[model samples]
Target: MTTILVTGGTGTLGRLVTERLRADGHEVRVLSRHSWPYAVDLREGTGLAAAVAGVDTVVHCATNPRGGDEQAARHLIEAARRAGVRHLVYISIVGVDQVPLGYYRTKLTVERLIEESGLGWTVLRTTQFHDLVLQVLQGSAKLPVMLLPAGVADQPIEAAEVATYLAELATRAPAGRVPDMGGPEVRTFPELAGAYLRASGRRRPLLNVRLAGKTYHSFRAGGHLTPERAVGKVTFEQFLTGRFPARG
Candidate 1:
C-alpha cells in the first residue's frame, strides 16, 4: 500500500478524507499546525521532509479562502516535490475559473502552480458544502425578516462525499482537471432559505431581496454549479431533514 499524506487533515473535509483513506488500509498521515491523533504537522517545512519521507502521494487539502492561498499551495507543492512524492491531489471548488472572486482567484493561481510543477496531479473541483448553507441559516436566521438574493443558483454538495471523491482521486492516476461535482438539484438562494426555515421550524418570513452587484450577477448566471457535470447523491432536502429531523 502507498503512503498518503493529507494537508489540513484536521479540518472538516480533510478529517473525513483521512479517515476514509485509513479505512481503505493505506498508510495515511496528516499535516497540520496541530498534530492529530494519527498524524503530524509540517507547518514550517522544517519536518515536512521527514513527514513525507516515504510517502507515495500527497493530498493537498490546505487552503485559505480569504486570500494568499496561492503562496501556501505553492509551498506545499514544493515540499512534496522535494520529498519525492509521486502524485499530488488538489482539492478545489467549482466555478473557480469563472467567478473571479478573491477566493476563486487564489484557487486558480494554485491550480496553475500544480500545472507548472509537471508532477503527476489531479484537481477535484467540488461545489459549496452543505455546511456553508448551515452557516447562513445560523448566522442570518436572527434577522427579523431574512433577505435573500432573488436569483442566486447554487448546487451545493456534501463535505463527506467530496472527501470520498478526493480520496478516490488520490488512489488513481492523475487525470488532470476532472469533471465538476455538485448536488443533485440546482436551487436558488430563496429556496434554500425557505428550506432552512421549514427544517428548523422557524416562523420568520423570508424576503426575496434582489441584490445588484458583480458577485450576485455571477451567482445568478449559474457560475456556482456544473449543470451537465453535477453528480452527487445527497439532495438539499435530504441534508436538511437529516440535520433537523422531523419528530414523530
Candidate 2:
C-alpha cells in the first residue's frame, strides 16, 4: 500500500478524501493545523517535512483563500520536493482563472506554482460544493425577504463525490491538469434558495436583485459553470433533502 499525505484533512472536502483513501486500504496521514495523528500548519511550514517524509503521494487540499494560500502552497511544494514525493494532487475550484475574485486569484497562483514545481502533479478543478451553497442560503435567510443576485448561475456538486474522484486521481499516475468537474444540474441562486426554503419548511419571498461589478458580471456570464463537464450525480434538491428533512 502506498503512503499518502492529505493536507487540510480535517476540512469539509479533505475529511471526505481522507476517509475514502483510508477505506480503500491505503496508508493515510493527515496534515492539518488542528487534526490529530499528524498536525502540520501549512502556512508556517511546521511539521510539514515530517508529515510528507516517505509518502508516495501528497494530496493538497489545504487553502486559506482569505489570506495566505499562495504561501501555503509554496511551503508544501518545497517540503514535498525535499521528501521526494512521487505524486502531488491538487484540488481547486473551477473559474479561478476566469473570475476576478481575490480568492480565485490565489487559487490560480497556487495552480501555477504546482505546474512549475518539477514534481509529478495533477490538478483537479471542480465547481462549488453543496455545503457552500447551503451556507449562502442560510446567510440570506436572516433577511426579511431573501434577495439573490439576478443572472447568477451555480453548479454545486457534492463534496463526497469530489472526494471520491480525488482519491481515484491520487492512485493513478499524475496526468497534469485534468478535465473540470461540475454538478449534474445548474440553477440560478434564487431557485436554489427557494429549494432550501422549501426543504426547511420556511416560506420566504425571493427577489432577484441586480448586481454590478466585474465579479458579478463574470458570475452572471457563467464563468462558475461547467455544463459540458457536469459529471457529478447529486443535484441541489437531493442535497437539501438529505441535509434538511421535511418538517413533520
Candidate 3:
C-alpha cells in the first residue's frame, strides 16, 4: 500500500484528501502544527523529517496566507529529499502567475520551487473554493448593503471535489502542472451574492464597489478565471443549498 503524508491534514481540503486516500486503502499520515505525533510546523521545519519518514507521496495542502510560505516549502523540500519521497503533490490557485496579489505571487513562487526540486512533483491550480465565497458573503452579511467588487467574478468549486482529484493524483505517477480546474460556471460576484442572499433567506441591497489597483483590474479582466477548464462538478449555488437548507 502506498504511504502518503498530507500537510495541513486537519484543514477542510486536507482532511478530505486524507479521508479519500485512506478509503482507497493507502496509508495516510496527517501533519499539522498542533496535531499529536506528526505535529510538525512546516514554517519551523522541526519534526518534519519524522513526519515525512517513509512516506511514498506528500500531498501539500498546507499554506500560510499571512506569509512565510516560501520558508515552509524550503523546509518541506529538504525533509522530503532526505526521506526519499517519490512524489510531491501541491495545491495552488489558478492565475497565480497572472495575478499580482502578494498571496498569488507567493503561490507561484512555491510552484516554481517544487518544479525545480529534484523530487517528482505535481501541481494542480484550481479556482477559488466555495468556502471562500461563502466566507465572503458571511463577512458582509451584517452590513445593510452588501458590498462586492464591482467587476470581479468567481468560479468557485467544492473543496470536496478538489480533494477527490488530489487523492486520485496522489495514487498515480507524478504529473507536473496538470490542467487547471475551474467551477462549472463563471459567475459575477453580484450574481453569486444574490444566490447567497436567497439561500440565507435574507434580502439586502447589493452594492458593487470598484476599487483602484492593478489587482482589482486583473480580477476585472478575469485573470483568475479558467473558462476553458470548467471541470468542477458542484456549482456555487449547489454548495449554498447544502449549507442552507430550504424552508417549507
Candidate 4:
C-alpha cells in the first residue's frame, strides 16, 4: 500500500482523489490550510513535512486562481523534493500552452518545475470541469444577456473523471505529459450556456456576440479544446442531465 499525500486536498478534485485513494486501501494524507490529521500551507511554509512524512507519492492539485500559482507550486515542488517524495502528479488544464492566460501560464511554469526537479512526474492536462460550466452560466445570468464569442469552441469534461484519471496516474509510473483529456464532443460556449439555462429552468437569453480580439479569435480557432487527444466518456449534455435532470 503506497502512502500518497495530496496537496489542496480540500478542493473539488483533491477531495475526491483523496477519498478514492483511501478506498483503495492506500494511506492518504491531505495537505490543507486548516487543521486536519495533518495541515500544510504551501504558501506559508507550514506543516509540510508532517503532511508528506512517509508518503510514497504526491498529487499536486493545489492552484492559486487569483495569481501567485507559480510561486505556490514552486513551494510545493520544493517541499516534496526535500521530503523525498517518490512520485509527483500535477493536475493542469488543456490548452495551457496555447493560451496566454495568467492562470495557464502559472500551470505551465509548474509543469516546467516538476520536469526540472529531476523527480518522477506526470502532467495530466484536463479540459474545463462541469462545475465551471455551471458556474459560468450562473454568473453570466446577472447581465442583460449571456454573451458568447462568435464561433468559439469548447469541450468540457467531468471533474470526477479527471479526478479518477489523476488517481490512476498516482499509481502508475510517471508518464511525463500524458495525452490531453476532454469530453467526447466539442461544442460552443453559447450552446453550453443554453443547455445550462434549459437545465436550470432559467429564461436568460443568449446573445452570440462577435468578439474581435485575440482571445476571442483564439477561442474561435479551437484553442480551448484538444481534438486529437480528447478522451472523456461523459458528454456535456450527459453531465448537465445528470446534475439537473428536471430541466425546470
Best candidate (score: lDDT): 3
Backbone clashes for every candidate come to 0, 0, 0, 0
Error of 1 at 180 (Å): 0.9
State each model's CA lDDT, in order: 0.82, 0.92, 0.94, 0.83
Tens digits of lDDT, candidate 2, 56-95: 9999998885788888999999999999999999999999
47-140, model 1: which lDDT tens digit per residue? 6667777889999997656565676666677777887888999988888888868888788888989988978999888889998877886677
lDDT of 3: 0.94
What is residue 73's positional error in candidate 2, in angstroms? 0.6
lDDT of 2: 0.92
Q: Which candidate order results from sorting by TM-score in descending order?
A: 3, 2, 4, 1
True-vs-predicted CA distance for residue 39, candidate 2, Å: 1.4
Clashes of 4: 0
Q: Which pairs, if any, clash in model 3?
A: none
Candidate 3 residue-wise lDDT, 159-234, digit = tens: 9999999999999999999999999999998899999888889889999998999999999999999999999999
lDDT of 4: 0.83
Cα RMSD for candidates in order:
2.0, 1.1, 0.9, 1.5
| Candidate with better TM-score, 1 vs 4 | 4
Q: What is the lDDT of candidate 1?
A: 0.82
Worst 10 residues of 2 by lDDT: 239-248
Off by over 4 Å in 4: none
What shift in Å separates residue 69 of candidate 2 from its native position after superposition?
0.6
Error of 3 at 177 (Å): 0.6
TM-score of 3: 0.98
All candidates' TM-scores?
A: 0.93, 0.98, 0.98, 0.94
